[model samples]
Target: MQKRRRFKQTKTLGQRLAEEVTRLRDQARALPPGRSREMLLRKARQDETAIQIESWLRSPGLRAPT
Candidate 1:
């Protein structure tokens, strides 16, 4: 039987997502305005949204839906 490979993440999800967003934005900025650039920007926006949601979830003000 093959064992699954295990690895530890050195960075938190928020950190990873933030890095990805930064990378995507930088790539998009380097490209000419077009579908590829738009797609990269879209992905960066999604990552930013994910970061926001993660922060909101971890915030002390978060409450269970009544």
Candidate 2:
């Protein structure tokens, strides 16, 4: 049997990115040593950037992503 996912609207890009980051981290962990370093670091940076942007988007007058 397969499980179904609920279709709730996401409030911010960070929420989406968080899910992606989680997946990336899992993949990074499974990667062979030589291939993991840069990929993991890049994903971490993207996650951090998403967090900052998402927080910024919550500001009273902040602009949405294009």
What are the models' TM-scores?
0.86, 0.57
Of the candidates shown, which would achieve the greatest lDDT relative to the real structure?
A: 1
Cα RMSDs of all predictions?
Answer: 2.6, 6.4
Predicted candidate 2 versus true structure: per-residue lDDT over 1-66, tens digit per residue: 999988877555777777788878777777777656667869877897878876877878887765
Give the deviation of candidate 1 from the true structure as CA RMSD.
Answer: 2.6
> Candidate 1, residues 1-66: lDDT per residue as tens digits?
999999999999999999999999999999998999999999999999899889889989797534
State, as a TM-score between 0 and 1, how close model 2 is to the true structure: 0.57
